[model samples]
Target: MNGAPSTVWFDRKRIAPNVPEDLESIDPMCEEIGKVIQLEVDQGIPRNKIIVGGFSMGGCLALHVAYRFQQEIAGVFALSSFLNDNSKVYKDLASSDCRRPPLFQCHGKVDPLVLYEWGESTKDLLIKAGVMCQFHSYPRLYHEMNKDELDKLQAWIDQTLTSS
Candidate 1:
């Protein structure tokens, strides 16, 4: 499997409408991912075989893109991430008729950077939107993935790939 890493920077004050900003950055990031998906399609790969995932900011991006992409994808894997803008995301999800794939979200309970509550809230949002989400929380972990998280992630991937 090939992995792609992308970086984007934005001023927090400029983006924040409320406590949580409407992340306009997701738009360009999704466009970039869309191009990558198109490239895979051009190379004869089916869209359903493509799983979009990431850690932290990347994970947030993955969820935003997958939920709004207008196509059914394999699955989404998010670690230590949360929704950027709840109202916008909910609206997008509610209006879409595309097949919503399963989501696996892993978070560290003691994470200082991205609070554990944020992760749980994100999972709750997805679940309320009628999306299937598997959420795992680690007791003393903080802002990083552990071995147990990796194992669970692997199982989720295996199950998702096999069932799909």
Candidate 2:
């Protein structure tokens, strides 16, 4: 939840390449993140007290992990990321019984990589699935975070942190 970027290399077990035989890769970075969360939980940190978030690729993984382990996290924050899974993930996301943990997403209107429309599309998918979410899109910004977006994200964490 530091909001800082992490640049760690992934080992084989932590990665699942999206190939014909391995269309769903489990990022090794996620394992590291899970360990961090478990460590905090073991140290008496309330499960709800822990927040998971990241940017771009990290953001996508954050969403994926939160969804994969929904019962373990209180909330999730994903910025400029997309929910990627062949078609199963989308099917799961669109299913009626899917209960989404609280989610926050921010995207740049001019993001060239993931495209702002993808964010909007994800928002629409969540809405269709009855997922409760807070989303924001800034005009004229690219893939990186801006001061305003960070401030808003901070406010969201503050609000969700205290809420049941």
Report every candidate's CA lDDT: 0.79, 0.69
Writing each residue's lDDT as its tens digit, candidate 1 over 18-122 gives 365445765777888889988998999888888899998788778877888734789999998877554466678888766788999999999988888888888
Residues forming the 10-long window of minimal summed lDDT in candidate 1: 9-18
Model 2, range 11-80, lDDT digits (tens) per residue? Answer: 2222222322122344455676788888999999987777788887677667766665543577888888
Off by over 4 Å in 1: 1-23, 85-87
Whole-model lDDT, model 2 = 0.69
What TM-score fits each model? 0.86, 0.77
- Measured with C-alpha atoms, the lDDT of residue 121 in candidate 2 is 77
Best by TM-score: 1
**TM-score, prediction 1:** 0.86
CA lDDT, candidate 1, residue 97 = 66
